[model samples]
Target chain A: MENLRLLFDAPILTVQLLLDGILIGAIFALAAYGMMLVWGVLNIINVAQGELVMLGGYVAFFLFKAGINPLFGVPVAAALLFVVGWLLYRVVIFRIVDKDLFISILATFGLSILIQQLAKVAFSPDVRTPQAGFGTISMFGGAVTVTWIKIISFAAALTTGGVLVWFLRGTRMGQAIRATAQNARAARVMGIDTDRVYAWTFGVNAAICGASGALVAMTYLVDPYIGLPYTIRSFMIVIVAGLGNISAVLATAIGLGAAENISAFLFGAEYQIAFVYGLLVVILISRRIVLARQRRYLA
Target chain B: MSTATGKMALALASAALLFLYGPTGATAQTEGDTINLGAAVSLTGKYSVNGKNTKDGYDLAIKRLNEMGGVKVGGKSYKLKIVYYDDESTPARGAQLAERLINQDGVKFLLGAYSSGLTKAIAPITEKYKVPHVEGNGAARELFTEGYKYLFGVLSTSDYYLRDAVNMAAEVAKENGRDPKSMKIAMAFENDPFSLDVRAGILEAAKKHGMKVLVDDKLPPEINDMAATLTKVKAVKPDLLLVSGHEKGATLLVRQTSEMKIDVPIVATTHCDSAKIAETMGKQAEGILCASQWDRTLAYKDKWFGSADDYAKTFQKEFNYPAPYQAAESTASVLVFADAFQRAGSLDPAKVRDAIAKTDVMTFYGPIKFDETGKNTKKPMVLYQVQGGDYKVVFPSKWAETKIKYPRKLPTN
Candidate 1:
């Protein structure tokens, strides 16, 4: 009977834990969705994606400091980063995409280091945050506390995601991009300028990444080095979602969040992030095993 | 095969092999030969502030030693040259640098590393190479327990720093008529071995004072969202908060604490040496207490630290930041290495190890003597509180040059 009582009590903590996980998971999805898009179409992993986000954050921060409203700075930062991304793709990434896979990886990693070091040299490693607009809103008899800034930013991300999904599904440029991704040679033969599509796709990814960073800055402080961890977390989410599954991205994020919370509650906060990495290792191992078995069956 | 001539030749060949690969083969340096020391300081990462300061301290010591005509041994003075590599506070990179230092650089003495994880990672390479490692900044107890004969730590552990800070906090709480026993304490530490050792100290001290730890949290090394952690800390309503981490982590925590209006006094370990923390937190960091082995502002009239103030002053004048806690540690390490090499009267690796094992010298930090476990004895920690945005000695009043601020909150003019 005592054990039953304990079990009943566990659900309340579990629900809270899950809720915390899902909230953080939502943030991860927003952060990594751009990477998935860039990877799926361009066939080159954008290692500097996190740095682009950081650039966006700094832009928003400076704009806010210069007397612009933070909410208004998001789109402006996104647009600025879009142009920068477009230029970067034209100058750097596009030149290296056709190179060997290892070379491309090295180029992007080098680009990441260059961007990070540039940021370090230009803007010291001090933490920055866009000025806050609205405060927290209480929900569910005060059991849940949601910040207005978080809600607005997260809602904006969802809308942007929906708009992207719609554009890809319903627009001419989107169709061309999809066609290029599915069969580049076929699309090129049918009069699609595949190189132009790559540029546009890469620019769009950078713009979205910027928006995510700006939104992140509104709710959280960002230091120059936050990009590396963002990259790791984004890769963790994308890999765990089993690749090419958009909806599973959210599910993976939520799973990670819940896992982190449970680990914190049971094992203590020191092991919470460690718990997330452990789950990532498990997921990666399982995927490898599944792939090996499938390859054996095919053989 | 068993012929007498064959057996004699085989025995001779085995003897040659032993001479090349055995313990005696750990790079036999002659009395007149120069001893190479490898330094893998943080140099450029988050701990760069302290790492650079430590490097400066190291360079200054090495320069002074060389100017004194080097270590005199066997009727000759053989100058020491340090082959310094920047590990940038990454443990994996530190390990790689350690391997390079041992295998490629052929260094028999290692003298720099600030982070505990970095030191722990590089310690094994020293053991494998059969060279003595004189740790400068790291303070994890686990490093001492590894049973490696060649590893010697010069600084007090994170455990000492945290316990001293907490004990001081407890003293303040008791004096202010707050029930020290019932006072809620929150432990927020970085998720690393150094912080873990400090956390252990906090728990131990809290138990001693009968204080209840209401909240405990660990932030990742790359965490920037200390807002949530601060919120959790506030919810606990702790009378005291113990923070164990390095410069960046310390700065973020104090800043977030101010934003959340969590007025609970902070008790930090030796991680408070970074100038960035004071600059970032500004007014918010005032009154936060920390325990350390040495603060640059502290001057003992007759001590070696006082004598080294000119060296520390140069660093402060150049960088516009106070000298780091590890500066004295690194400086002491150079002195220890010089002393050992001089005592050994030879630069031979085994002889140097023996000399270091038998080291008994005074340094900037204190009287340095290594136990059988290669842990330094006579190393003591002092408590300091940030008063008027400057860290001032407050505890061990015998050594306290400034008046102690006994209660919480910064003293008003």
Candidate 2:
């Protein structure tokens, strides 16, 4: 009977952990969704995508200083970043989209360094966050704690993700985008303006990144160097979700979050993040092995 | 062709001599009349808070000094210009920056990096260059033990600050009528060199008091989970919890502990003395105590220390936030440097080092004196508690500008 009671209590904690994970995972999903969309359409990884998110957070923070609510500042950040992204695409990424993959990665990596250094000079290296009340709240038997800004942020991430998923599946423009992803040459031969599509894809991807960054600021504090970690996490999420599947991204996020929570509960909090990174490494290795076998069999 | 080869050989030999044995080292004062100051700081990484603040403080001091007049070098007035480089918080970067500063910038005086790791890494370079270095804000005791006569530090060792907390805790326990010796102490410290030094101080103090150490967990800087550690802490049920780390890491540990329904008398070091803690933790921060050299409410009554009140006011007016330890260290560094400059009576690096080694300067905090080893003498420690979303100094009743209502629990409006 005592064991039964303990077992029953575990579910409440587990569910509470899951909810916390889902809300936090929503932000990760949004971050990964942008990566997927850009890679699918433009065939460029957008290495500086995390910095775009960081830039968006800074934009929203400043706008908040200008007496605008951070939530309201989200679209403003996205719009401004859209222009920035459009320029970057036109000047930098646009030229290299046709270049070799290695060259494109290297160029974007250089762009990341430039953006990071500029951010370091412009924004004081000290961290800043919007004044959002994110105190804990109790729900059910187990307490679910999150910032109010994070609650709103998670909702926004989910809404954006849902809308993007719908657009990709249902819209005519999204269809053209998918067609271009499948075969860019064929799509171009069929009268699609592939270059324009690529440009729009870059802007849209940046907008997603900007919005995600704006939302992330409510949950996490950002220093100038937060870009590298965000980039690593996004890459991990994308790889874990198995490339292009948005649904799989969400699933992987939930699993990753729950694993961190469990690790926190079992081990010291220091090891919780280590658990996620470890999982990412293991997943990638096993996936590589599986791919190698498949290639060998095909040969 | 043979005559040309001989001329080329002569030129190459001269270049090698200059490169291997510094050409500029021979000249006591160059035609440029410039005294180069080498600085390596984390102007871009996580430690940039103190790094950039130190830079700003150094600049402000230089600006004020030059405006008043220039540093007297020989008989001529030499304007001070710092040749600072970003170390990026990496050892290799620190060494490289140090090399560039000494070899390229021709800096005769060096200021060590913000953290102890960077400081220790660049110490060899300073030795190699034979330049006098003033260690800025890197509080590890190992820097002092390096046996380098050129390296002089202005800040008190982390051991001194951490010991201040343990001593204050003992006093608090005795005042509360608990047998101080019987008190079980649990300590959680960041795994960084600063916190390790602090932990060593705590252990030394604990042994002095014969107090029982129930739990000792040293955590890394990037710990995202602390629940298990807290669980161990709860099992031990120590009378006091000494949690130490950077701002976010400390705050997260406290928050996680609260979520686990673990509440004990928690005392943190200067790392927790910021508006960031109260803003993030809210009610969870209540009753949490800490010790620092300066608090915002310090009245500028002491003439020797200048005006902490004015400094605080100016900082807040400019930054739109309360001045934390970073600002305090910056202001303190400037005050120490200026005092040393005055006592030295010249911009000669050796003389300045000698002056800093010997002179006692009155500053905003109090009468500042450095012993031969370069730790601050007469360091006044203030104890503070988070009371209803505000940090109030309540201990050492002489300086208790405000009373902290202790054991303040949750649902405190």
Candidate 3:
């Protein structure tokens, strides 16, 4: 009650919360975009989405250590992760691509653990941040503060989303991917090498995660186990946005981020995660209810 | 052919039996010239960093003790050796490993796991088995409240971690000519056994001083951001901001507080050294007060490690990193076991348990005197302020390296 009154009394805090939420949400949306693509095209949940992001952050971290600016590490990480995703698709993900959803979930979950453990061994379990040196921007006489790295992340997310839309609409490979997503068998019959398409789709998804992860490393600290939360957040955002809706995924991710921030402010940080999972439950139940009503109407 | 085959099979059967029972027999509390201690520490997973520290502390103590001709028991010298199993940082695994160490390996004496949660899980098993367990890492107050006679902790309870910070804030408030009762405290603690216990301690201290708790937020274990909580801090403008969430909590609190520039009069936290904030975050970590179990500069000396500074130096040379309090207290736990072994003059667990109960010793870590509840009553938690890229002790005037930097000036970068 006191916190709610404080929000009303000092509304600038609301702006700060929302701005932070939106900036963070943009990265969440970027991860979700990759998840949405893999879910739609490859029919795999890609539970290792967060691991890819974690690996991407490590890439930027190493680059920073090597005396390269982490800002340039964004594209480099994406490119490297693209190859990693392609190899992973060939080695393991390909076997589960055509399997049941449950099988894919279990397989990818195992992959997530494998990647996390390997990263732990390779990088050690230390919370690390690649210093972007972007500094902070104060607004309204320092009443609201925004980190420059976060703004860069926000801009990167937007640009990636725009580029993703253009790629899917303009390129011939994009049309082939769309066709495969619509009907793999039909696309295969039309001489569209659907196997390559699936591999590319998975690779592209990982690249997106890599880019988001670089931004995340610059914005917040990254650790080996930090990937699971990003996976959960991306999964939630994809569910709320639905499959194949790029704009909706972006908007819902931002909205979820804002709602999480506001709810944390009102309910205390202890309930922040509880609130997220609770909202997931509510969204799922309401959707089921609406579907049930439609079935009744049909009957 | 039947006679020769039967003879060979009989010999092989006897050999297999010997192979199985030989190792179990050797794993007894005392083997020949070595005293074996069993420990289940985190070698992997979330607590691995601290787990490694605990293991190193134990190893360093064992190495030093062995070099000094080991512990003299019953008119003979016995070297110390530890049988270790990786707990994987899970409470269930820790409990299971404790049972395995006791039942299967026949390890009579046990050392502790890393965190309080794992310790809490293993404590019941040790109590059930009548094994003497001495630990340095697990510091939750609830562990002491459980009435486990066999579980002796060398470190102060978790609640004491941030309590001194709260008291210091109150003192600062009074010094500034403001009513201490009018002060508001905002706390963000990780929702874990250890951190919540720290929160409880801070709350008690705040209540005793008649301070209002404006924001008591429980951060999720997987939290990467606390912007929402910080936003509330901005609005409420609490007199003091207290955060306790282990390494991640300390790191995030320092980073976000600087990024958001949420300037409260006092900002205090735990795990600043473990998180390496002074070294990594540098200018941003300046003026932030951190609660610690032990600091290298303390005037504590012992026969084994000489002084606290000497122990830290040896540890850094061995481990390639500065020894956090986790490692210090862990080393102290090993020292406690060695002392008990020497005093009891026996290899029996019950005798060692009794000796450990009557422990009144001073070491490089601190004077460790456990009360009836297995809680160390002699040690006081210290507070450190990050000054010019180093942790300088600024509280508990006896060991003060420097005076407290008042009101924590925000870096003008």
lDDT of 1 by residue, A68-148 (tens): 877776788779888988898899989876677677678888988998999988988766656555655544443345556
On residues B315-380, what C-alpha lDDT tens digit does candidate 1 reach at each position? Answer: 577557766667777888888888887788776778988999998876656667898888885565
Alpha-carbon shift of residue B350 in model 2 (angstroms): 12
TM-score of each: 0.67, 0.70, 0.84
Candidate 1 chain A lDDT trough over 10 residues, lowest sum? A1-10
State the lDDT of candidate 3 residue by residue for A99-141, as single tens digits. Answer: 9999999999999999999999899887887787878999999
lDDT of 2: 0.69
| lDDT agreement with native, every candidate | 0.72, 0.69, 0.90
- Whole-model lDDT, candidate 1? 0.72
Ranking by TM-score: 3, 2, 1
- Binned by DockQ into CAPRI classes (incorrect, acceptable, medium, high), candidate 3 is medium
DockQ of each: 0.15, 0.11, 0.60
Q: Per-residue lDDT for A120-169 in model 2, tens only?
A: 88986655655454455555532334445657877787788788888878
Cα lDDT, model 1, residue A125 = 71
Error of 2 at A4 (Å): 20
What is the DockQ ranking, best to worst?
Answer: 3, 1, 2
Show where candidate 2 strays beyond 4 Å. Answer: A1-19, A74-76, A139-151, A264-269, A288-299, B1-138, B148-154, B179-191, B202-264, B267-291, B295-364, B367-374, B377-380, B383-400, B411-413
